[model samples]
Target: MGEAIGILGGGQLGLMLAESLDRLGRDTVIVEPDPDAPCSTRRGNVLAARFDDANALQIFFSRVEVATFDSENLPSMPLAPFAGRLVPSLEVLRVSQDRALEKTFLAKHGFRPVKHAVVPRGADVRAAALAFGLPAIAKSTLGGYDGKGQHRLTTPADVAAMPADAPGGWVLEEVLSLETELSCVVARDGANAFTFPVFENLHQHHILDLTVLPARVDPALQQEARAVALGVARALDVKGLLTVEFFVGTGRDGVRALYVNELAPRVHNSGHVTRQACTVSQFDALARILSGVPLNEPRLHTGGWCMGQLLGDVWLAQGRDGGPLDLSAWRDFPDVVDVYVYGKRHARPNRKMGHFVVRADDATTAAERARAFRARLMGR
Candidate 1:
């Protein structure tokens, strides 16, 4: 029998990771709160319990040879007992779970991040805002994603509106005039590391809407982004995968440069295009690392590819009246390579329910086709 690997969350990421593990001839046990989570329906070994359930974790740990988490929001202290089995280590989670800690770690390690100040709970928000300057962004120090727990302060009134009761505090950052957003995913196993091609991402309301592979940037800049991502992995002594998101824009002095925006210590949403564009997908790379296999550099196979996220809004718009989505329009687009639905039972606005990929002769064409297909899917 092959080794049994345990996953901490059973969201779409976990579901995809399990698929990769299964392809590699391994067994998987998913620990999730929802009985109908995407992973639950895909795999047989599921521990349907809250992530913090100690007894459940004990049972899960006993059944698997190694474990990793899908989300960074999980408390690191609770996983301390299983530290030996965790790939990236609890310290990574410790630094990543808090925005202040993550930014400080980047600056301490000589990586350029946006200028920011930490505002502790009940602190003088006005003072921090004044220091960071107007038009800054206030983000929760912990548990913020998909544009939640964030406030844009463009004036005095906005600063005053900052909540004083936020338990996790906040990090106020000077907003930059971005030229573009880029991301790179790196896979490492302590001894060696490999990076994927840089991806240019488009966002809607701070949530990723599309990703273009082989980013439409100068080759030199793309190389620099990949180097930055690899540097992050080495600095963190990471195992499995680490994705670094960057803001390519003009700094305060008016010089264009890349600034580290955030880091995801596991497979990232933006890297989904790798499934069709790369020799080894991000999920496969991470699964291989977790299963004690050597890491291999992922090479891009297609000339052009674009990945479009399918949010719950599409489901609500197309199927709110009840019944599965009418996917008949998909037949018209031959360039559309794949459609991945998460099998989520409920469709609320902005929730990620699925994604699709398009491949073409060039990045521009692929991006256009992807957008058109997404519009068709949403009945736009």
Candidate 2:
């Protein structure tokens, strides 16, 4: 048997990661709070222990050669004793766990980012809003993702009434009138790092809807985005998979530039397309890193492919009528559809139940097929 790999979270990402590990002829054990989690169903060696349970986590860590995380919730203090054994170190998670610190780090590195300010309780929220400007975004600096802990600030009154329950305070950022959003997912071991092509992302209500590889953007802007993302990885001394989200803004003069929006210290949702479209999947890099293997650059496989998500809202209604609805018709699109269900017990509004990856002959075909897939699920 090969070295045992330990994963910190038990989400869809963990499920996919374990699958990737199995493909690589490796062994893995997942530690999660939910005993009946989706990931455990996929990988049998799952430990149903909350990650914050230090004693249990320590015991779990002792059995693995190295560890990585599926989400950013895991902190370093608990994983420190296994320093060299952690694929992405504590500093990477520490800087990424808080949005404020992430934005500050980017700005200090000369990367263009939306103007932002931190807003905590008993602080002048209105004054902070004024700095970022109207139509700003107020988000919790920590423990937020997929549009949660995030709100739009359209006016001064909106800022004054900021939610007191926000985590790690809040970060107010000027809303960029962006042309589109793009993301670059890359991987790094201790010494070498590699980047994949930029993927254009479409978000509906702050949740990822579709991702197009080799995003339709100016070549110069794409290069800049790649550079900025790779630079961030280096600065953080990150290992394993890292993803950076950017806003592609079009100036009044019609020129385009990239602005850093956020970072994911682990494999990202945008990178889901990589599984079928890229020369090397992010999970492969992650496996290589933890197994003490050198990292190789991921190449775009024939201009790459596009991946779209089929959100839960498409099949179920809200309130009293909401529950697990059948998706038997989904299997019909085998030609263009690569459906991945999370196996979640309950379906909620806007929750990411699963995603589909469609590889068309070209970007246009890929995008159209993706849209058609979404429409079919919605009975359009």
Candidate 3:
């Protein structure tokens, strides 16, 4: 076998990344503590150790030629030994890991983000939030995703009701008049770079529910979105994949414009539609990039593609609990091209279990079909 690649986390993203590596005949060793993580089924390939296990990392480093992380939440200090071999570099992880740092970085680079103020831990959350002004949100600076670690303050009372101490401090953002959300996945290998079709994403309760492309926006806005994504990748000088999420809304200036929302310096949930929409999926692109394979720009197929996330709630609704979901219903929707289950050990509300892709003649049709399909899946 050829040299192996190491992954820091073994969740669904890691599983998909491993599958991509497998196609390149590259072995993957993952250091993840969760015995029931999505990649746990890989058995011997998994270290089944904590991220900070120095001894396990020594063993892990010895077996791999290169390393990449699936999640930025992994402690960077533990992986210091393999810093030289870390793909995408550790700086990307550091800057993207904390919301405050990320926002400051963006603003420094002249990218407009929602205006806000940072409230340090142990400080007054309510007073700080009110200072940023009422009708805002306070998000913990670290380890928050899928709508977690967020508190909305629409009134002074709401701000006063906020927790006294935020675990990682907080970034309070003035609420904008939201129009829609969009994302662009940018992949790079040194001098070469590629951008996938800009994806228009729809979130429910702060969790992404569906993503469709080409985004149903003005052609100019789509172009601008892609340009901004590239600019972000260029600014960071990152070597792997970066998915930049954007908000199109009425900004504090009272003009509808695009603002950087957040950054995911790895394969993102929003990019899963690439598996069917483009010649090169996001996972495949990252796999090749990390493996030192040359890349040709991916060509988009002539159709609309929509990826609908299947959260754990769907499992409970189907009466499976933690068991395998009933895929018997898939045969009913021809447009539903693919279904991916993460092989998770349990099912609970809002946890992303898998996603499915639908293809149609246009973006609207594809999104409509995807929503209808999931609705039927939930009903039956």
TM-score of each: 0.96, 0.90, 0.97
How well is each residue in 1-380 modelled by candidate 1, as lDDT tens digits? 12599899999998899899999898999899986578778655888988888898888888898998898988777688998888777888778788999999899998888888988888877787877788899998899999899999999888787776554788988889998999999999868789999999999999999999779988998988889889878888888889999999986668788999999899999989999999999999999999888777899996889999988888887866322566788999999999998888778888888899999999989999999998888788
Best by TM-score: 3
Instruction: Count clashing residue pairs in model 3.
Output: 0
- Show model 2 residue runs off by greater than 4 Å: 42-44, 120-122, 250-256, 317-337
Shift of residue 36 alpha carbon in model 1, Å: 4.1
Better of 1 and 2 by TM-score: 1
- RMSD of candidate 1 to the truth, in angstroms, is 1.7
Relative to the true structure, candidate 3 reaches a TM of: 0.97
lDDT of 3 by residue, 169-220 (tens): 9999988899889999999998788899899999999999999988999989
The global C-alpha lDDT for each of the candidates, from Candidate 1 onward, is 0.87, 0.78, 0.88
Clashing residue pairs, backbone N/CA/C < 3 A, model 2: none
lDDT of 1: 0.87
